[model samples]
Every structure is written in structure tokens, then in C-alpha cells.
Target chain A: MQFTCAKEDLLTAIGTVNRAASKMQKTILECILFSCGETGITLRATDIALSIKTEMNAQVEQTGDAAIPAKLLYEIIGRFPESDVTFKSVGENSMEISCLNSKVVLQQMDADEFPIFPALEDKEQIKLPQCVLRTMINQTLFAAAVNEDKPILTGLLFDIEPGSLTVVALDGYRMAVRRQAAISDIARKCVIPSRTLREVSRIISDTEENVKISISGNMALFEAGNTEIYTRLLEGEYINYKNLLPADCATSVKVETNMLKDSLERASILAREGNNNVVKFEISEKNLEITSNSEMGNIDEQIPVITEGKDLVIAFNAKYVLDVLKNVEESEVLMQYNTGVSPCVVKQENSDAYEYLILPVQLREE
Target chain B: MQFTCAKEDLLTAIGTVNRAASKMQKTILECILFSCGETGITLRATDIALSIKTEMNAQVEQTGDAAIPAKLLYEIIGRFPESDVTFKSVGENSMEISCLNSKVVLQQMDADEFPIFPALEDKEQIKLPQCVLRTMINQTLFAAAVNEDKPILTGLLFDIEPGSLTVVALDGYRMAVRRQAAISDIARKCVIPSRTLREVSRIISDTEENVKISISGNMALFEAGNTEIYTRLLEGEYINYKNLLPADCATSVKVETNMLKDSLERASILAREGNNNVVKFEISEKNLEITSNSEMGNIDEQIPVITEGKDLVIAFNAKYVLDVLKNVEESEVLMQYNTGVSPCVVKQENSDAYEYLILPVQLREE
Candidate 1:
């Protein structure tokens, strides 16, 4: 087999597919199937749970195939200067790569042992701009449960309706919900692994270009530009999170996003030393008082805010509050509290595109 | 005690002395002795082997001392916004820090238990531009022995003459020597620990400002601007590296520093897979051919060069050669070779500011 391609183009393709190949695998699963056809060169890698396939333009000399170690090939191509690199099969299990005055012969695995990329039939499809999809994933993915205690909570639920899509993720402590307008004929829902969503977000360009997502029986496919990602849908039903959001609150406050984030970040410095990382917030007339204490030190900070209704005092894990505040891009955010021990709900001041529910820690009086 | 100062100034002073305080220590050594008097605020930390003291201007309301944890103070000050910060002793073991609307009361160790800074007598002194001293240390420190197999070899030798100061470091395989002109009243020699030199290099400004270096019986003092660094000298005789340089060579090759560096970096990718990163070089009349092979792959690269005298082939540890190439800022470098087994001498093409001798690895015929 022989083909020539630009180093940059090949490197990008390898990088996208290598992410899947680098995961813990057995035998030939760790290699990427590199093949050249009449159209161009195609690279595919899979670790049984997740798979990626990408294609790039290349000048095909002879059509052939080989399974190359994904990471080694990526590293080698990255080091090459910006120039055209040519790959030619040498023997039964060797491939020769040459670029400029440099030449390398790399060992290759048998292409016959590599798994085939699964062909998918779109049972339901939804299309949205890459930028919108990226925002939805980034804002909600952080709340996904990292441990497998519930199995289903480890994945983000992608709920699709006739004209809207909402992504939701919740650990036991916090939940994030993002809603975007996307048109689809059939209503469907699927839980995608957090790892797959993260990689998809990284691979998709943050531009106005649209990415088409197709969901089938137990697999979901993401197609954008010349790359395709196929991942296994998590099994089991996700928790019903709609009933958990508080409908009304006795106290409401509006504050600048950056001001709250910065104060919480400082308060977390001391709170991080303790097991619970609890920071107390005393919301009153026109100011929010935040305080945290540990064995080593204690910190007290105050930021101005507009408050309505009755005053409230609550405590929460600083990390959860900080995470939501950081993900929120609005200049001003509105927070609602029903009681000291009830979960607090934060939303954008003027828009309802995103909502966050954070459970408060039970504060013990000293 | 009460004092107020700009957060930036306080942060910088704490950062400088905090390096020495962060090292593993016992009791109060882990804390920085923060004191305010007529000379402003003085901060000192010691790990017995190395110590640092620095001073910054502050509004001294009342003169007093407290031992503050180095890392904690640094982190807290770094998080505060740019503003005036005030510190006051709340009680016997607590220091209250206030900045803007943030207040923190940090636990402190007893100040009386902290060790006092040592007094040093300048038996011999040398003053040179901070930039020159920084360059001398940077150009040679990489060759210092990392292990304590030979206690003295782990430190860089400071050979101070009446008009020149030469810094040399060598492991068993390679040696780096840097020399610069500096006037000294009396000739002196001392082996400074690599850790001390590294910290000194980091603290010194890379400018034309002069730094006064004082060498006493057992400790060396480096005073630059408002910072003072005191370190214990390694006690032993340094290796005699002057005689180790090859007097002449049978072959000489001049190549672009970046071109050779890039070629070797690519070759090293394959060479690194083996137990020893040995890359072979064939110096002919017009080209330098480099090659390396391992179980995974083999790379062959060639770069044009001007070679005078007999042709030669040699092999070396790619890391040593790459280290020197990365350090040398010259566009072109001159490499002299005596034989395949003899040490290769690398120097600046037109200047004698730095010299590197790398021992060649024995090339066994396959």
C-alpha cells in the first residue's frame, strides 16, 4: 500500500481517532486501521466501548491496508516538519514512511484482525450547530457522576422532543440542565457516557457548522465534517430530575457571576482543608456574607447583591457552587432558596436556557 | 502588632523566601519568620542546608514578629485582588489579614522558636552582571550529576580567578564548562550545591544589574536587589575538567544548531525505545547521516554540513547531545571529533563562551 498526505492533516486525523485507541484495550484493539482507497485514506480505532473513524484527502499510489500502533504513529507524524509524508508497505508486517530527508520503518499488526467499523441506520436524527452542542455538553457534563454507584448517572441523558433537546447530568450533590431548540420528527432519549461526550465535544469544531447525531438501538453516531464517532448507549433508566427542581422559594438574590465565583474560590481555599468543604452563606438585605473555617484558618468575605423576600442562611460544598458559577457565562445570576437545608436553584437572570440545582450541606451550629 | 502593605509587594517577598521554606524541615523551619521593624518587614526561612531572607517596605504600625506558614501565606496572598492589605496580631497565636472586604485569621507558630539568620563574612567577593551569572549557571547546570554517588560531583564547581570565573559540571559521561570575565580581589574556589545554584538562578534578575557574591568559610552568600540567599557549600574537591578536553581532533564538522537538533530529536523517537538512547552519526565530506533502530521502529535522517579532514562515524546518548544543543543559543555550532570512541568537543562557532564534551558510546557492529 502507498499513499502521500500533508503532515498536519494526517496528524489531526490520527489525534482524533487515537483518543479511542489509547483507552485500555486488548490485542489488536489498540491499533488504528490505516487504509488507502480511491477516495483517500481512512483511519479507524475502537476499544469495544467506543469507536472513532476519520478520513483525510491523500494521493493514493496503491490501495492497501495496515494496522498501525495509534500512539506511535501519531507521535512520529507530529514530529515531522510541515511537508508531505509518504507511506509504503515494505514487507508482510512492516510499513516504510518517508518525509523530506527522513525515513522510518515501523512494525505493523495484521489488518485482518482489526474490527470493522459498525454501519448505522439512523433511527432518529437531530441536527444542531456545533457551538450550541458544545455549550450544552460543557455546561452539563461536569455534573455527571464520576463513580458507578448508579451506573446510569455516570452518563448524561440526552432527551429529544419534536422541537427541543435538553441534556441533564446530576451527581447526588448537584444537577445541571441545559435546553436548546433543535428540530426532530420523533421523540427519543439516550444516555451517552461522559467519556464519549467529552471526546465528541473536543472533536467537534466550535463553529456554526452543524453536527448530525443519530441514535439507533444501542449505539449513537456523531457525524461532522469528515469524522464519525460511534459510542455505546448506557443501559438503564436515568433518574427523573424534573420533580427535584424547586418550584418556589422564600428567598431570591441576584449577583454578578464573576463576583460570586471569585469569593467562592477564595473561601474554598480554607474550606478545602476540611472533609465536607462547606462554606456558609448568609443572604440578607443587600449583601451576601460568606464564611469558611478549618483547623488551620478561617475566612470571611462579603459581596453586594440584590435580595428580595425573607433572609436565609445556607451552606454548600464550595466545589459544587464554584463549578456552576464558572460554567455560567451570564453577567448576573439569580439564586432561589426555600429553606436552609433545601436545595438551591441558580438560573440566568433574564434567560431560562440553563438551570442548576445544588444540594446544601446540613450546617451544624457551633 | 499591626502593619499594612501592597499585596503585590508582600506576595513577591514571600515568594522569594518561600522556596527555601518549602523544603522538608523540622519544627519552625517550615514557617517563615515575618517581622516588622525600622527596616520594614523582614522574612526568613531555613532548611539548615539552604536559607533565604528578603525585605519589603511596609507601614509598620507596631513592630512585632510572627511565624507564618510559608505555603499557606503565599496561596492566600495570591488569591486576593490587587489592594492594600493589613495584618494585625489578633492574639498570641493568630494573625488577622484584611484586604478589601475579605478577612482571614491564620494560625501562626511561635516566633521565638524560629532560628536566626546566619552572619557571613566576605573572605572573597566577586561582582558581575546578573545576566552573565545567570547565563553561566544555565549553560552548565544540566551536566551536573543528579545522584550522590560522588558527593562532590553533584555540585557545580566555581573556579574564581583574578579576572575570570569558570563554572563547570560533569557527570561520568559529559561535562559542560562556562566561563566569563569578572574582577575578583583574591582567587577562590568553591563547589555550590546544584539545588542552591538553581534557586539562585531563579531568584536573580536577568539584567545588567550587579549581584554581589560573597564566599566565606562554609557558606556562600548571594545578595541581589532586596533578596539574600545563603547556602552551605559542598565539602569536597571538584573534578579536574581542564585536562579532559581534547587538545585536537582528526575531523571537524560545522552544522546549523537547529537543523542538527531537529534531526536528532526525530531520531531519538525511535532510539528512546531501547535501553540506551544511542544514535549513530556518520560524518562524511558534505552530509551528517544519523540513524537509530529499536524493536518498534528505525529512523534514518541526513543533514548537510561542512566537514574538514578525515571522515568519521560515532554514536552518543541522544539526551546529552540534545541538552547542549538546546542550551547553546548560537546559530551554528562546531563539533570536533578525535575518533569513534574519543570524546567529541562542541563549542560556539565563533566565541569561546561555552564548551561541552560528550563521551561517545561504543558502537557494536551488527
Candidate 2:
């Protein structure tokens, strides 16, 4: 294949797709297959788990395919002269790249060795504004399980209806769920891997354009401006997170998000030394007190808050509270607790919007 | 000890000294001992390999001593309000810190359990400009051995005479040595651990004022401004780097530092796939050509330069050459080489101020 394209466009596309390429992998999986034709040149990469296919318009003189090492190709293309770069396949396993006065001959692998990506059928597709989905993913994905020990927890549950879309993630320790007005009429639910959500968020530009998403059985496809991202779904049932959240909380308090976050972070340093990074929160009629103690020492912080109901004392992993506070959108966050042993719920003061539920750690007797 | 000091000052002092604390030791060697009295507060830490002591002027109420985890103390103190913070020993193993409306009591190790650092004895000391020593250390220390397999190579060699000072470091593969005009009349030689040199560089500010450096039997002490750094000297002799550098070379070429660096960096992406990241440089009367090839591909870059010798082709580890070029001072660098297998010498074009010798890697047969 022979074609010429802008250096920056190719660099970005290659970099985005190469993220899934394993550095230690010695096979063709580390190679990004490039196809050039009269229309344009397309770059594809997959580890048999997730695949990214990107097409960039280029001046095509010949049609061919070559698989180049993802990392080397990206680096070389990034460093090439800030002008149009021409690529031409010279032999079965080599391609010539020329730009300005510099030329490089890159070794290539057989494109046929690359795994065949399933064609995304034009079935049930949901269209959503990029920014809305991006925000929802960012707000809840952090609570997803990082390891596959409990495979279902590693995926975020996407529950969609006619008017609203809800995304929930839980690692058994903490759960985050966010709801947004739906832009599509389709009603469906699927568990998309947290990693796929993160990658989709990263690859999607800040443009206001809509991203078209399609789910077929166990595979999902996301199509944006010029990029297509495909990820496989986890085959398991997600836990009923709503059942875990307390229906009636004994005490609830509204405090400034930033102030509460700062106080909790300072106490976390002490709390982190213990078995579970436990920190105690004592809520009174008009004040919220946070405390943590270890063999190193103890920290006590008090923040003025508007509170209702009886006084209560609860202990939890300080990190969990900080994470919830960090993602809260409103200036004031409302914290609700039933008993010391039950899960505590945190959300923006008066909205049924985004909510976080965190299990408390039993306080150790002094 | 009881005292109140600005949170910023306390945090800075703790951070500087915390570099000396090691987590490997079972004893609370990772803790920084704080002594607060009526005059000021002193923070000190040591792992027996290196020691750092810093004094911060504070409002002292009563004298007290406590050993707190260096990292935790720094983190906690850093988060305290920018205003003055109060410190009071709550009991034998805990200290209370109050700033703004925040109060934290840190558990401390017994002061008696902390290591007793050796006194900075008034010995034969050499005074040198802080920037000069700092630059020399940065230039050569990157070449020091990281593994303990070669003990002596892990330290930076200090060679001093009546009016000159030279620092050298090598990891058997590549060596760098920097020389400066000494401001002191004393002549001495010692080997300080590379890690200690790095820490001292971080703490020492760039100042025109001379820093007093004293060498004892097995310790090196550096006192500058308000900080005192002590490092244990490595036992055994350093390699004679002068012998490794060739006195006479068959070919020599001068090239702009940045031009060569950029070209080498571009070639590095291709070279990285090779066994040793070997990049070949062919110097002729008109140009400097850099090339690297692996199973992945090959890259050739031609940079214009002025040469005074016959055409020659030499190959060396691209990373080594990049490291040497990165630290050279002059705008133009002079490269001298005899053959493809011989060591390549790199230095400033017109001066013998700093020299680098990088062993060439043997070229694989095509």
C-alpha cells in the first residue's frame, strides 16, 4: 500500500489504538495492521479482548496491508517531520516511510495474522451526547472492581429506559451510581467492562457530537466521529445495589463538599495506618466531627453543618468517603447514616441524582 | 518539645530530611526525630547510610523530642493551614499538632530508639560553590551503578587537588567525569554513595555562596545555608576512568549538541528493539548519519556537521550516548573514536572540562 497522511492525525490514531497492545507480547498482537486504499488508510489493533479501528483520509496511490509494531510505529510517526508522511510497502515484510528528507524502512508482519474483528451489526443502537456519557462514566467508574477475581464487579451496569439512563459500579466495598436523561428511546441493560468505559472516555473528544453505541449479545460497539471501539461484555449478573442502600437513615447532614473533603483527607493519613483506614464520624444537631486513631496518633476535625434527626456516630474507610465527596457535583454534599454497621449513603444535598454507598468498618475498642 | 511553626516551613524541612529515611530497616529508621525548644526546632533522619539535619526557626514554648514517621509527618504537616502550627507532646509517644481549626495527634516512636548520628567534626574541609558541585554531580551520577553487584560502581568518586576537583562515575559499561577549578587549597579523595549525592543535590539550593564539605574516615558532610547532609563513603577503590579514555583518536567530529541529541532520540525508537539499543553513527567530512535496525525495521538520519578526520562508522548504546550528550555543557560537542569496537570519547568542543567514554557495542552480522 502507498499513501500520504498528516503526521499528527496518524500519530494520535496509532497512539489511541496502541494502548491495548501488550508491551511484552511477542506475537502479531503487538502490531497494528494498516490498510491503505483509494478511500483512506485505516489502523486496527486488538489483543482478542478489545479492538480499535480508526480511519483517516489520506492520499492513496496503491492498496495494501502491513502490520507494524504499534509502539515503534507511533514513536517514529510522532517524531517524523511536521508534514505529510508517505508510506509504501516495499516487500512482503517491509514498508518505506518518507517525509521531508528523511526515510525509514519499517519491518512489517503479515496483516492476515491479525485477529478478524466481528462486524458490528446495525442492530439496537443507542445515541448519546459525548459529554453526558463522559461525565457519567467518570463519576461512577472509579468504584468498579479493578481485578477480575469477582468478574461481574469489574464491569459497570448500564441500565437504560425510555427516558433515563443509569450507570452503576460496585467492587463489593463501595458502590457508585449515576443517572442521566436518555438521548435514545431504546430500553436495555448490559454490563460493560470498566476498562472499556475508561478507554471510551479517553478516546472520545470534547466535541458535542453524539456517540453511537450498539450492543449485540456479549459485544458492544461504540462509533464516534471517525473511531470505532468494540469491547466484550461480562457474562454474569450484577448485584442489586439499590437493595444495599439504606431506605431510612437515622441521621443526615449537609456540609460543604470541599471543606468536608479536606478534613477527611487529613484524617485519612492517620486512618490509613490501621487495618481498614477507619475514620469515625460523629454527627450532632449542628456539627460534624471526624476522627481517626492509630498507634501513630489521632486526628480530630470538626466542620459546621446543617443537620437533622438524632445524633449518630459512624466509622468507615476514610478513603471511601473522600472518593464520594470528590465526585459530588453540588457545593454541599448530604451524608446519610442509619446505624454504625449499615452502609452510609452520600449524594448532592436535595437531588436523587448521583449516589454513593459505602460499608462502614467496625470501630476498634480502645 | 513544644513549639509553633509555619506549616510550610515544617513541611519543607520534613520533606528534605525524609529522603535519608529508609523503609528496609526494622527499626523506626523511617522516622524523623524532631527536637523543639525555646529557640528553634531541628528535624533529623538517618538510615546509617546517609543523614540529613535541618533546622527551622519556630516559636518554642518548652523543650521536647519525638520521632515520627517521616513520610506521614510530612503528609500531615503539608495539609495543615499555611499559618503557624502548634506542636505539643501529649504524652511519651504522641504529639499534638494544631493549626487553624484542625488538630492532629501523631503517635511517635521513643526518642531513645532513634539512631544517634555522628557529630560533624571540624576536619579538613573544602569549600566549593554549590552550583558547581551540584552540576558536576548531576552530570556524572546518572552513569553510576544501580545494582549492588558492583559495590564501588554504585558511588561517585571525588578526586581533589590543591586547585582542582574532579567527580567520576561509571557502571562498567559507560563512564562520565566532570572537572572544575577548586576554590579550596585542600586535596582529598573519597567515594560517596550515588543515592546520597542525588539527595544532597535535591536539598542544596543553587547559590553563589560556597558550601563547606568535610571528609572524615568514612563519612562526607556537606553544610550549606541551613541544611547539613552527611553520607557514608563506599569502601574500595574506583575505576581509573582516565585510562579508559583514549589519548589519541583517528577521527574527530564536532556537532551541535541539540541536533545530535534529537537525531539520536529519533533513532532510539528503532534501536530500542535491538538487544542493547545499539545505534550506529557514520561520521564523514560533511555529515553525521545515525542508523539502527532490528527485526521491526531500520531508521537512518543524516545530520549536517563539521568533521576533521576520515570517514568512520561506530556503534554504541543509544541510551548511553543520549545520557552523555544530555549532560555536556558546551553548545558544540566533540566526538572522538578510533574503531567500531573502541570506546567513543565525548567532550566539549574546545575544553577538557568534562569527558564521557561509552563502550561501543559489536555490530551483528547481516
- The models' CA-based lDDT, in order, is 0.91, 0.85
Instruction: Return the interface RMSD of the candidates, in order shown, one decimal each.
Output: 1.0, 1.2
* Residue A350 lDDT (model 1): 66
Q: List candidate 1 segments past 4 Å from native.
A: A23-26, B23-26
**How well does model 2 score by local distance difference test?**
0.85
Per-residue lDDT for A208 in model 2? Answer: 78
| Angstrom error at residue B94, model 1 | 1.4
Runs of candidate 2 with Cα error greater than 4 angstroms are A20-26, A242-245, A364-366, B24-28, B120-122, B364-366
| DockQ, every prediction | 0.81, 0.68
TM-score of chain A of 1: 0.98
Error of 2 at A56 (Å): 1.0
Which lDDT tens digits does candidate 2 get at residues A1-366?
898889988888897788767575468999998888779988898876788988888888999888888887888888776889898989667899987756799878778888898776656777778888898899998899988799999889998777778999999889998988766778988999887898899988777798888888789998998899999988888887778777797888888998888888899888888546888888899888998877767899989998888898888888888888887778888888888788888887667778899988887776
Q: How much is A37 displaced in model 2, in angstroms?
A: 2.1
| Candidate 1 chain B: 10-residue stretch with minimal lDDT | B21-30
